[model samples]
Target: MYSAEIILEQRTRALSEINLNGFGQRHQGKVRDFYSLPGNRRLLVTTDRQSAFDRILGQIPFKGQVLNQLSQFWFEQSSDILPNHMLSVPDPNVMLAREAQMFPVEIVVRGYMTGVTDTSIWTMYQKGSRQMYGYNFKDGMYKNQPLATPIITPTTHAELGGHDKPLSRTEIIESGLVAEEIYTQIEEKALALFARGQELCGKGGLILVDTKYEFGLIDGQVAITDEVHTPDSSRFWIASTYESRLGQGQEPENFDKELLRLWMRSKGFGGDGAPPALDEDIIARLSQRYIGCYERITGREFESDLTQPVAERIKANLEGLAL
Candidate 1:
């Protein structure tokens, strides 16, 4: 059990010694590369690669830093809500997190209906269907409609090229992956975190619309793992215009992947094929959006030296790791 500071030191050392040819490549997700570390812990590195609609687009400068810092901000803020697997942040794009058996489900909670998935929900409503993946939905709902209360919709984590399927609580329990008591604990903690997130965002003049959460078992206890309320895991809407946008049937101004999704859709590219290259202007605008998200959410200016070379910065941070 390394303290956060020690873990950060170790990560810096490891980065200094990172073999470009053999960093013990463990697994590669859409935008992250996982490297094995001592014990069961793994080093998660956020690369510059950008992915939308499940397809990897060209790399965007500093995109990885934005994600890493965003996750770090949320982890620090929400530690009081529940224990997270965060051990330390080794570098701007690297995290030392606890190794746990990841529960196969992605827990999604929605406060307001919006976006493509929400549209899918409405389509199900119009067909008089009360359920999606066995979860019931009431009929005749309009867009951006508020739920009587927030609902938890769980979906199974899928492999590459595979689609995640929704699962009922009952199914999750019967699968024997987790005990009913533990599953209940996950539910309680997730909602509590979301509530806190809502409160914090409200103060920031933002609305936490919806988000996905992942959990893993640490020493037989379920804990929040991976990233928390970052822009990647959650949607943030400008608070002031939320009501006006809903009344006018306009989408709320948001800070999240929605903008990238819109760009992809405009080019008639879905997730299945290669994505079009984003122009420099669009890239610059998106970069600013990420920076803005950090400042607005944390109420602190982002003071990163983006002009420095990533590899050099990483090498300096890892100086202590050299044996």
Candidate 2:
């Protein structure tokens, strides 16, 4: 575990974008930069740039490496449940993956009713909304309360700088976005993946509160694509304090990006004109939280090389792979 003081002293930077020669077209997402490779493969580079409310929130130190390594860990751990896009981890901040026909929906699985976003179920419920994405919630449920069972609430995949609207299962098929048969398969896979996440986090004394999964068609089969169970894609709370916190009307201690989101909310930024610039202290704390998430979830020490530049290290590793 890295002490807060040590993490601040290291003070590494968020990686800048890179261009690899001989790679095909490049596609950049909120946090990942994707480049097409030969043989239907793609090179995905996770950058340190932080994004929330569907907007870029500057850079958090070592953010890219933490997300990439954590996603790589989950991809390897959960491959048996479903075939994923990952082919190999060429570097600490890079993953070479197979390109797939991406599904236009984000499969969000929720086991709790807490979040700071406008689209959060708790926000909607608190505003007197009983129905959400075809799931009905009964009255008298407290904030951050666990559900009877995990629910799959999907949303349309939005373009960059766009908001993702909530989508019901029926809307997905009725709108001709996904065929009924394929949607059924996606639902099954999403729930199974969530179960796997919950089981793993449970052993680590954490709760996989909710997570979003992306899927794509690979060789006529739906395969998991994008990051899975990372702090960026999921919400995790310390299990030991969950019950007491909820009872005391206190927020649970989270290891995910929710902490940053909360801080931004305090600054009155919410998918608006411009986000507030984060300071070095906030950056250091966020970096430690990310590293904390990695250690607690994977049960491994996060090996961050502050002495070496991240771009150079990734380039060297990729060259070694001869890709």
Candidate 3:
């Protein structure tokens, strides 16, 4: 791991984008840049661009490598529960994955009534709506409190620069977004994945609070796609400090991107308009946090290859794959 000073110096050096020629048709998502590859596969290059509430905030040094590697870790750990699009990781920040027809709505499994985003279970619960995501919420639930059981709240995938809207199981099926039978299988697999994640995270003294799971049809069968249990796609908290802090009505120590979201919220920005420029200090801190998340969750040390520029390294590493 690099020191704080090195991380701060790398703020401007973070990789925000990398477009390779001859990589076939390219599609840009919030964080990952996808390009069609041979053998009906896709090359997913995770970038350092930070995003929340469906908005790109900024970039953090080494953020791409952390997210890509962490996702690769969980994908291997939970392959028995469900297959993912991951095929190989030739580069620390890139993944060669099987192409799948992605389902339009993402399945969110929440073990807690938390989050500040518009689609958060807590946000909707606070709005005085008892019916949410096809589940009825009774009164007396406190912020950040764990629910009796985890719930699956589906949300539509927003276009670039568009806000995400929440959906229920009934709504998803009724809209023809997904068939009833396949959707049920997706839901069951999603819960199983969450349980696996929670079991592993519990051993590490972290709580896998909630996470968003996306699925796609691979060979006409359901498969987890995009990233899984990555800090960018999930919420985590320190378990030891959770009950104590919540008893005092304080927020738990965040171990995921929620820390950054909370910071963005403090800056008076949610998901609307342009986000303020990320300061050097915050960028460095977020970078450190990303590295820490990788270490804590995977039980591995976070290391960066500082031999060359990030973009140059990635380009060279991918050149062989283009052959």
lDDT of 3 by residue, 148-253 (tens): 9888999998777666788999999899999999999999999999999999888878999999888999989899988888888888999999999999988899
State how far residue 97 of model 2 sits from its true place (Å).
Answer: 0.3
lDDT of 1 by residue, 1-323 (tens): 22233322322222212333335656777877777666787777776666677776665555677788878887888887777778888788778777888988898877865547532455556556677645666656777777777767788888897787767788889997567998899989888888888888888888888888998888777788877777777888888987888899897787776888888788887665677887655565666666677777788776655445565776566556531
After aligning candidate 2 to the native by TM-score, how far in Å is the CA of 232 from where it should be? 0.7
Residue 96 lDDT (model 2): 86
lDDT value, candidate 3, whole model? 0.86
The predicted structure with the larger lDDT, 1 or 3, is 3
> Which residue ranges in model 2 land beyond 4 Å of their true spot?
3-13, 268-271
Worst 10 residues of 2 by lDDT: 5-14
TM-score of predicted structure 1? 0.87
Q: Write the per-residue lDDT of candidate 2 for residues 147-263, one digit (tens) a residue.
A: 899999898898876778999999999999999999999999999989999998888888999999999999999899889898888999999998898889998988787778778
- lDDT, each prediction: 0.72, 0.85, 0.86
Please give the lDDT score for candidate 2: 0.85
* Candidate 2: clashing pairs of residues: none
Error of 1 at 189 (Å): 0.8
